[model samples]
Target: MKVYLWVDKDIPNVYGQVAVRAGSIDEPADFTGLAHYLEHMLFKGTQEIGALDWAKEKPMYEQIIKLYDEKAKLRDPKKDKAKRDELTKKINELSVASSKISKGSEFPTLIQAAGGTGLNAYTNFDQTVYHNSFPAYQMENWLKLYYDHFQRPVFREFQAEMENV
Candidate 1:
């Protein structure tokens, strides 16, 4: 990863951005909105940040992933309405269960607690960028949080996030 630092003594806040080369253009043709969906999922947080009980949540989350995968495979929803609806119902059920053990929005909550602002990310045709500005004194906290963010992002609210995408 390439790191860029701009130090301005007069500024009270430090702005950090991490951009990845992959974006909508990188998604498989069949999975058009996947990149954007991923952008939303990244904020859901990792095991260390979002989960109150990862042990119990992991299996339920895996089931949700599997259901989504199956749903994705059934191309024509009209033709496979029964199967698709079944999968959708299961995904929703698992998501609700998973949410029970998840600390939803904890990632941004942490940043806000540390005096951060503009905590957001965007996905474009060629790249996806995550960024935020934090009080200069909170630089260390920002770095550690983002490091964990990229290293171990969990798809906690997949179905709900997909709706936003």
Candidate 2:
């Protein structure tokens, strides 16, 4: 709740933002881009937004990760192209299967529906920020949205987002 406000009567809308003091500088050497990855994942959706039935999706997700690990171990491109391609195909199929039951992009859609503008986030050396602009009267709605957004965001679509990164 560390909100810093700059009030000006000339403007009809308010620019609100949230930032966490964790970024690349805070990431471990072995996981250099984890923080930035997390920043990107934040928009993918929370548990309530982008999610499938956990009871069924969990086991498949685990199997996909295991397959990816196995593929990584055989990293010689020229020597393992066929095997790698097979593993990749399997991963993609599993991902699509999992996604079939999940819902995503709900958060941004909510903001947009509320007339929010500039809905986005970014990660830099020392911080990760999520920000948006809304009409002055929507402050209460904004607070609630922020609360739900950060409470427990589910890392949905990990493989796709990782590929994007």
Among these predictions, the greatest TM-score belongs to: 1
What digit string (tens of lDDT, one per residue) describes model 2 on residues 49-140?
56657677767767888987999799699999999999989988987887877665778888987889999888999999999999877878
lDDT of 1 at 151: 96
Which 10-residue window in model 2 sums to the lowest lDDT?
A: 45-54
Cα displacement (Å) at residue 71, model 2: 8.9
- TM-score of each prediction: 0.88, 0.73
Off by over 4 Å in 1: 8-10, 76-79
RMSD of each: 1.9, 3.8
lDDT of 1 by residue, 90-138 (tens): 8888888889999869999999999999998999999999999899988
lDDT of each: 0.88, 0.82
lDDT of 1 at 152: 89
Off by over 4 Å in 2: 4-11, 51-93
Best by lDDT: 1
| Model 1 accuracy (lDDT, Cα) | 0.88
| lDDT, residue 41, candidate 1 | 87
Q: How many collisions per candidate?
A: 0, 0
